[model samples]
Target: MNKSRFWVVGGEYTSTDFETLIQGTERVVGPFETRGDAERTWRVLSEDHRPQAQVRFTIAHEHLTMNA
Candidate 1:
């Protein structure tokens, strides 16, 4: 099985909002300081989380990704 990772940009959302966005669908990969930071973190997580079939998203970016 393989998973996927994504980073969101240009959005205004709180941590709770991000959590809700990814609720029950994926694992939050981080609480990044900024969208750019989340993007960088997503790259690292893509390698590890992708193989495990665990959806990964960044709370900072307010984006979600599921296995695909």
Candidate 2:
């Protein structure tokens, strides 16, 4: 079986183009059990940094194998 995990990734980028992130400004939120949880965190992060035009955040997900 496989389980899905969610995370929030991204941070302040070097420019508005978002090609590269500024060193030391990268942020990785977590491996949330559900996408909804991850989204909630994402919203907070986005809103908190909304004033910064270069700051951004997005939700990401990955599947993990579960052993029985």
Candidate 3:
């Protein structure tokens, strides 16, 4: 069996191009059960960091194997 998980990943980047993230600025929000939950959190984080043009965040989805 398998289960889907969601996460919010990102933080301050080194530049506007967003090729690299600044040291110690990387952030991982979590393994949310649903995309909606992750999106809500993403919205808040994005809004809070809206003033920083170099800061960005996005939702990442992963599939995990579940053992019975």
Candidate that would win on lDDT: 3
Best by TM-score: 3
lDDT of 1 at 23: 39
Worst 10 residues of 1 by lDDT: 8-17
lDDT tens per residue, model 3, 1-68: 99999999999999999999999999999989999999999999999999999999999999999999
Clashing pairs in 1: none
lDDT of 2 by residue, 1-68 (tens): 99999989999998999889999999998999999999999999999999999998999889899999
lDDT of each: 0.46, 0.93, 0.97
TM-score of each: 0.34, 0.92, 0.93
* Winner by TM-score between candidate 2 and candidate 1: 2
**RMSD to native for every prediction?**
14.0, 0.9, 0.9
Candidate 1, after superposition: displacement of residue 47 in Å?
A: 1.4
